[model samples]
Target: MVMIHIPTHPLVHYPGDILAWIAASLAGWWQHRAFPRETERLAQVTPPGYYVALALGGVVGAWLAGSLNTVPSGLAPSHSIAGALAGAIVGVEGWKWLHGVRGSTGGAFVLPVAVGIMVGRWGCLFAGLADQTYGVPTDLPWGVDLGDGIPRHPVEIYESLSMALFLLAYVPARLRGRAWARDHGFHAFVIVYGAQRFLWEFLKPYPKLIGPFNLFHLICGGLIAYGFVWWRNGGVRADHGAQGSALSVSQPDDEPVRNLP
Candidate 1:
């Protein structure tokens, strides 16, 4: 089997970071266009300080989670998207509770977040060994050499592709006005992301923390659980105030994912 040589260049790596954010912006804009009113409703009910909590939580979570794994592994400090996601949820949820706001407010984030992850992971892939996100050596046909001569699983690419594929399915289903997609898209994103990450962890060379699982495995497990709980708490089966009693949205079968505020 042929192995591909992946360039380990800061130039290659840093550009992906920019492109990822740009892609997220474009996706967010597109989604906003697709559902202007729902977007507006999400905006109106969203506390002005919500963004602040999300940003702070994300930054801290990324750093803290990455460091916890890398420092112990004798690698330089790093940051993780998974950690950032977890942290952002904690921050936003905490803020919402304090403000007495509830329901699935992350609907607006589904596309942007998925597209962002799909593009951002390419940065990690190009960063190579220095980035410390590479997987264990493998004899697989698609193995890549990221500066190292040894062929290994391209875990970063796997994650990026996973998100990309998810978007392909989600967008079409969402646009078709699927009830489940309208109501629980964010939770689905969370659970799928977590599940995929959990599987990929096994391919990584990170030190095992519990049995054969690593730190990320634990974090991913929590994420999966969180997604289900959040979905049940704010989903179609939700008892009341899925929108915190201030506002509630209902989708119309006649309209494609249309939810009037």
Candidate 2:
């Protein structure tokens, strides 16, 4: 047997892992836009507040999930948290400026962010820190052995799956002009991601003592509760007319609703 050694040093491997995956995912997302069917419709679709909310939520969620916890498990430490926040703030504004205050999904904002996460988490998994740690141990064949005296759940995989499913749900609903598609899609993403994250946190090991629960769990639970309340309040769709109807961002008088059915 040729003696084969897995690289024991994390520093040697992490940068490439994160950089490559992130770069590739971004490239793929951008490339997908090149296809007219996938790219053109988004142009007309003005970015609603949901985009802004998700970006802000991601920053706050990522930060609280990473920093307030007993230890870091994902990409970027408190510093990454700062960077993520700054990037989101700047990115949204910059997007507004570039695309005009009337923003459109026609660009590469949403997909790339999700893709970047998918890539970045891989980095965390390899680096073996940050939000990468979590989930109950499983005897399933796919379980990862972190060599810390236990076979752990691969929480990152769970997140990646969640985001992927969200994107998948969003794209179709967005295109067909589903009723409350944008609103439900965006808010649901937040609520679902938050809830799943909270549940997953239960399995991971944290440094601080929080009576069997962590900060992320509480926050997620809160968001999920809010999501439920939010949905009950007629959801994002209630604010608008039915599907295929023009959404009057301004006062209804401005749009001149003609014989609304």
Give residue 240's error in model 2 in angstroms: 6.1
Off by over 4 Å in 2: 1-9, 12-65, 71-110, 129-138, 147-149, 207-211, 234-240, 243-261
Off by more than 4 A, model 1? 235-261
TM-score of each prediction: 0.89, 0.57
Model 2 lowest lDDT segment of ten: 1-10
Whole-model lDDT values for every prediction: 0.82, 0.50
Model 2 clash pairs are: 42-106, 72-130, 73-129, 73-130, 73-131, 73-132, 74-130, 74-131
Best by TM-score: 1
lDDT string, candidate 1, 1-261, tens digits: 579998787566678889999999999999999988768767755656989999999999999999999998677888899999999999988887776554667888999999999998889888888888899999998999988699999999899989988888889888987755767788889999999999999999888888999999999999999988866655332333222122332334321222221
lDDT, candidate 1, at 87:
98
